[model samples]
Target: EIIAAIEGLMKDPAVGHPLKGKRVLVTSGPTREPIDPVRYISNHSSGKQGHAIAKAAAEAGAEVTLVTGPVSLADPVGVTVVHVESARDMLAAVEAALPADIAVFAAAVADWRVASVADNKLKKGAGGPPSLAFVENPDILATIAKHGSKRPQLVVGFAAETEAVVDNARAKLARKGCDLIVANDVAPGTGTFGGDANTVHLVTPDSVETWDRQSKDGVARALVTRLAEMIAKA
Candidate 1:
């Protein structure tokens, strides 16, 4: 069934010729910043959306590479999957997997990491607790978007905002120097993180397209179709 779907996409002129022979890269899941051997900081991303995008792009006839953070999902057929744990690892992995025609930053990377990693578990003090300092992690999306060589022709970013979705998304798009930004609310009651459904606003410099809440697969198909069109025109 999956192969048949991919064959159908390959035969579809609108999606086929545009992505034919092109290389695409995608990032997914949550980066784990180690606090200790047994603990880490990460997000709630399930990597469903990113996986779907990789599948769709492969169906569209592109050579796809997925740089994923920790996730348990099976790798999509016809796509190269590189697994990484920390935000720094993800960044390095993505840089090494470059020369892609399009790059999608879909991973929910942690903003900070423990400044110092203890060699062994720290025991609680008699008086109080340990103070762990944190440092900012590299912004993967911004870094790839601004790379000098082997830069993707098109760069897209995901803005998982909790409030002011459109405004924050717009800011992220501009700040990250990405061509498109998919902004979605992850507030409580919204089934975004680890959920099958999503409601997102696609923000570009010229316009904003708000999509009705839909399944993650639906969103992936829609985004891939649009990407095919954009690449065809480019």
Candidate 2:
């Protein structure tokens, strides 16, 4: 952390815009799957990490487009923000923000949504609980990553897991066909869902690099740096 702080302080502001001519797309927060007008199925993602990445990208001079779900945080200055609710809505917004030089999938989109939505709020009744039919939501990460020509040059993904963090991320890296997977543990008590910091492992096809715990903003800045290097190498 000390070294990271020193590196950050040492970075020359004049050379900050390494991605000056680049375009970036980032997704944040958890998509809500509505069960009724008053109830929904969603995770605990806070959009902190995603928002930080979008902000860092803009600071690097990239033309950034942020597609986010319901979050209380203010929109990042200089970023084009697209607000979405359900997973399907998020998918549409993401598809619309295309042709990015780099794409980051940071949102914890719901895997399934209620097949049939209730028109009004559900109330207590003799029937203990109402049965719900769920259907798979669109695979946004894989869809964008597999897009032939419209696919971004660099695709990044995130894996929030309770166990086998690196292993799961490695599998996801192949399954989703993304260039990188930022893996972290979001199991109960990790405070990752709404926390300010993260400890992540950068998983790729060839290797895994574990980074020390740091602020979400710090991870974003460091990620942007790595992305610049990756794109340059490509």
Candidate 3:
């Protein structure tokens, strides 16, 4: 049964071969930064985009590992899935799954975490209010981009911007030291979160490719095809 599934994936036309025999790692969902045992900070990411990418990469004949944050989503077939909670945990999981040909940081990792987490949940009336201290979380994309060994040949990051989408994406591509950055606007009414469709700009070192808004599946397929071409040319 496993062999048949593998063969079926290999023969899928919507998939590509530039990534054949390669390994890909993808990070997805919103990382939780705990303030207390019962409270944490998180975002609204639904994990659809990253899951789609994982599925597409696997269908393209690549060994895909998805290091994901807590999300109520089903695992993509043919992809290895690792579940994590906090931003720090997600970073650790991605590092452990490394040495891939491609790494895509699609997770909306919280930039900051509580400096100290309370062992127990804070209760009202103990104090007027509880104060929280914050510290920066590790930049997983940058870390992988600059890994000492087995650094992926291609690194991709996502810029979920509410304004200045293209500009921010371009800056992130440079700042994160990734080969490409996909920028998308999450403005009100954009329907980026918990939506099946997306429109994004692919920012590279020298060019920006704007893709028409389409279903997440369509975007995933296109990205896999592009990755295949890049691997073939590399």
Candidate 4:
């Protein structure tokens, strides 16, 4: 059955996984930054791409560890999933499952979290709304990319931007210190958020390669295949 599945996947070119003996780590979904016990801030990440990558990695015969934020999807088969809510929690989870061959950061983590969260929900005052302060969240991709010894052989980050998609992605690639950045525009009404399809540009220090529009699963397979080749050459 497994051989049949692999042969079927190989025929597609975009859906074959060849990552045997590799250890892959993936982060997915939207991280919620809590403001109070009842309120929080988050984005609209659905985790489709990240989850698909994890599934593809497992299919490629890799041992996968998926560190994900809050989402409503079932866990992928043959992947070890670690559930987390906040950006801090996600970072801690990723750190705990380190020494991986590859790391993919696909989570739309909140850039800032409330400086101080109230123990209870803040009540609406008669005078005005409650004021909230924010602080920067941990830079998980950059952190792992810059790790001294425990760093993965390949570190990939996702950049969801509205303007200057490729340029911004290139900037993020340099800024995050990751090996590659998978960038896509998530402008309103683009269907990139919570959508199955994607148009991505693989940004690396050497070049930016744009891919044709395709399903997230196809993208995952192609990416895994590329990473496997790179690891083999390394």
Candidate 5:
């Protein structure tokens, strides 16, 4: 009876759960830009952080939709998962899952793709190395964040930087038109790519707040709490 009373005291006074009935959309991992059937351009994102966030949001009672790129991690429980490969595919999936209450874009999408893909693999001895042209990929975060009709009420982006983390995040928050930017240092020795822990800075239009190093799951829970509070106040 005591434990039940304590739990009841800690529960939200309003909604049963903080994010009850809210729909959240999250993009995770790294989008690959294919060069050939066997080769592609991509990054080192493990989807651990993004997956953790989706899990935490589900725990918080939000209806979560996780749109992910190629990654090895298993899908989070109680969340709808959409697996995609290239940047274009990810963008299309995100568009199809629109009108969410909050959207967190955590995928490290490839910036460029080969302009012309070879039907056959270009051999090393072919013309003494073939030159390739590249073109920019669609900016998914910016497109969704600035959407006129289907934009989420709150849009968050991630900035993985090697230097000037907060400064770069601030710039990205403005450029991407997102409500917030979660910036982290993924430099050579940061162990942020596939590691368990992370140190992040929450950059918004008004200020920046730094968070201590913690496990990816811990960060996810903390972020969910913060977002829930923000929604309550809004």
Candidate 6:
């Protein structure tokens, strides 16, 4: 209902289209890295938070482009959706949707991919356990945040951590060259992987804002408003 709220705000005389002319790009879900014809590597992200953010941005009157990975969620209304499968595909899609005013890298992209994928599923015979080699995937956030010409004015990234949440996020904010980092604890039993609610800490260069636990939609709405205000000040 966060997007619906934006519609409500639009009708109010006091609130206009704050992000009307802005271009927003959001990345969501988890990319799959192929291991074999029948197998792949992926994560447990449900795309709930990212989708909500995209919807919120669209509702706020921004021209939104959502680059997403495999998920079961429906596409957010009034937004352009680009579906991709792997980290490479996601990076390509993000690069194509360039010069965004705001970019949110919410996707839990794989850190590594299989070096060589099998053409066919390997049979479990006398070969025992097969050795699989891996290589690092492209750092999408870093690439976009460090872009020279096509860089978005504001770039955001997410840190799903089980320990040292704020510290790790702070490090990531600098390491990835992003303006903001949304950090959350995804330790087992947190119900963060597929749950609707989120407890997040927004880490920036100046300070950190820890928001109370709330639905993903609530967080999205608040974040969108905060970002719009920041852009306005800039």
How do all the candidates rank in terms of lDDT, highest first? 2, 6, 4, 5, 3, 1
Off by over 4 Å in 6: 1-16
What TM-score, over all chains together, does every model reach? 0.92, 0.93, 0.92, 0.92, 0.95, 0.94
- Which model, 4 or 6, shows the larger lDDT? 6
Q: How much is the lDDT of residue 183 in candidate 2?
A: 99
In model 3, how many backbone clashes occur? 0
Residues 30-138, model 6: lDDT tens digits: 9999999999999999999999999999888899999999999999999999999999999999999997999999999999999999999988999798999999999
Which predicted model would earn the best TM-score? Answer: 5
RMSD of each: 4.1, 4.5, 4.8, 4.1, 1.9, 4.2
Candidate with maximal lDDT: 2
Question: 1-234 in candidate 4: lDDT tens per residue?
Answer: 999988888786444446767899999999999888888899999999999999989998899999999998999999999999999999999999999999999999988999999999888889799778889999999999999899999999999998899999999999989999999989988899999999999999999999999999999999988888888888
Worst 10 residues of 5 by lDDT: 8-17
**Candidate 6 displacement at residue 224 in angstroms:** 0.3
lDDT, model 6, position 23: 98
lDDT for position 24 in model 5: 96
Error of 1 at 164 (Å): 0.6
CA lDDT for candidate 3: 0.90
- Tell me the whole-model lDDT of each prediction, alpha carbons only: 0.89, 0.95, 0.90, 0.93, 0.92, 0.94
Model 6's number of clashes is: 0
Question: What's the true lDDT of residue 208 in model 1?
Answer: 100
Output the better candidate (1/6) by lDDT. Answer: 6
- Model 1 CA lDDT for position 45: 95
**Model 1, range 26-74, lDDT digits (tens) per residue?**
9999999887777777889999989988988888778999999989899
lDDT of 5 by residue, 1-234 (tens): 999987877775445468889999999999998788888889999999999999999998999999999999999999999999999999999999988999999999888899987777767984696777999999999999999889898999999999999999999999999999999999989999999999999999999999999999999999999999998788
